[model samples]
Target: MVHRKHNRVDGKGRIVIPVKIRQAMGIEPGSMIEFDYMARRHQLVIRAVTETDQRAHNRET
Candidate 1:
């Protein structure tokens, strides 16, 4: 499924995720999301993060 939404970033660089997208992704108030920025495409990508993802990221660093 595709969820499309647009929201303004606050002065602190925080953007509000849409309720529909949140619900679909099972995101709670404190859920962690991963963000990837593609400078060439000028787009930002976001995805829900899991414990396994955290472990792999830690290993990489």
Candidate 2:
């Protein structure tokens, strides 16, 4: 696992993404990003896209 240290956002609620991580994750300018939290587990994750990317993997209900 990689350990990274970053600071919090400013009053405007904007945070800068480090260049190394951006390249590693293939994140480009204006790319879509999503954040999900598991309340029970107290965990948060940042992902590159949303559920729209999983339309093909859905099961018939």
Candidate 3:
């Protein structure tokens, strides 16, 4: 099942990801996250930066 939570950005423009969501994604301290804004879709996508993603990105460059 998918879990969803609402969070607000603070004055510093930082928003905290819920611990449940973080743990589900295997996101720990020092884990990198990538954010992508889909202008057409009017949505923001957040993903954990994994080694597989890094390898693919490296190959692209």
Best by lDDT: 3
Give the better candidate number (2 or 3) by lDDT: 3
- Candidate 3, pairs of clashing residues: none
Candidate 1 deviation (Cα RMSD): 1.6
Give lDDT tens digits, candidate 3, residues 1-61.
6999999999999999999999999999999899999999999999999989989999999
Minimal lDDT window, size 10, model 2: 52-61
Selected candidate, larger lDDT, 1 vs 3 = 3
- Which candidate wins on TM-score? 3
Q: In model 3, how large is the Cα lDDT of residue 48?
A: 97
* Clash pairs detected, candidate 2: none
Minimum summed lDDT over a 10-residue window in model 3 is located at 1-10
Give a tens-digit lDDT track for model 2, residues 1-61: 4748587999998887788777777779877777799999999787776356545335432
How many collisions between residues are there in candidate 1? Answer: 0
